[model samples]
Target: MTTQRTETTTLWRPTGPEELALVAASGWRAWPPRLPEQPIFYPVLNEDYAIRIARDWNVPASGVGYVTRFEVETEFLARYPVRRAGGETILELWVPAEELDEFNRHLVGEIQVVREYR
Candidate 1:
């Protein structure tokens, strides 16, 4: 007998940097069908981090860069697979592939905090 398998993946895009941070702030829902509430501190802190990066880098942000709007483009296994609870989705915004070097410069002053990323 043969078995079929499918992989799930979610694609999220923030309006800008702050929006990206906001989505990351939303803690990973460990439980499926019922995502429990988690600490808001990390999200808040991440928002702060994104904002500080914006200012220091002169990214020209109007308000908080928390992810305001996004949509799922495609999925790997599921029709629209969501992010794994507390997974790498959050990191995507931290180190955008487009502007990797620029983000690094903004992150230089934050070596201590970035230890988590490393």
Candidate 2:
């Protein structure tokens, strides 16, 4: 069987040239002992805030059941929504396996938060 490779655009960046929001990511991908890409990101803030974020992006929480604290830079990011760095309503969503391929077809990258601790 072939695993349907898809680009999961889990990060939702709202309108405007918003400042990047820091993100830390750990997931159930290849090389379980480590991460594949830069485990840090600064995408715009979405809706889910913390709990929802953990569900979609964090490795510990991606499975059938688990809890992880992924948002470490919330206070800092909330500072500049209208200033130099605008923002978005950060949210973590699970797209249907089929749409994953075209979810962020034109997007660039994932929303990976910085390395953090629970």
TM, every model? 0.20, 0.26
lDDT of candidate 1 over 16-114, digit per residue (tens): 343334334534211112124421112112333334444443244444322221221123112212323343433232222333233222221111122
- Which candidate ranks first by lDDT, i.e. highest? 2
TM-score of 2: 0.26
Q: Which residue runs does candidate 2 get wrong by more than 4 Å?
A: 1-48, 51-94
Best by TM-score: 2
Q: What do the candidate models score in CA lDDT, each in turn?
A: 0.27, 0.31
RMSD of 2: 15.8
On a 0 to 100 scale, what is the lDDT of residue 14 in model 2?
A: 21
Candidate 1's TM-score reads 0.20
Against the true structure, what is every candidate's RMSD?
15.7, 15.8
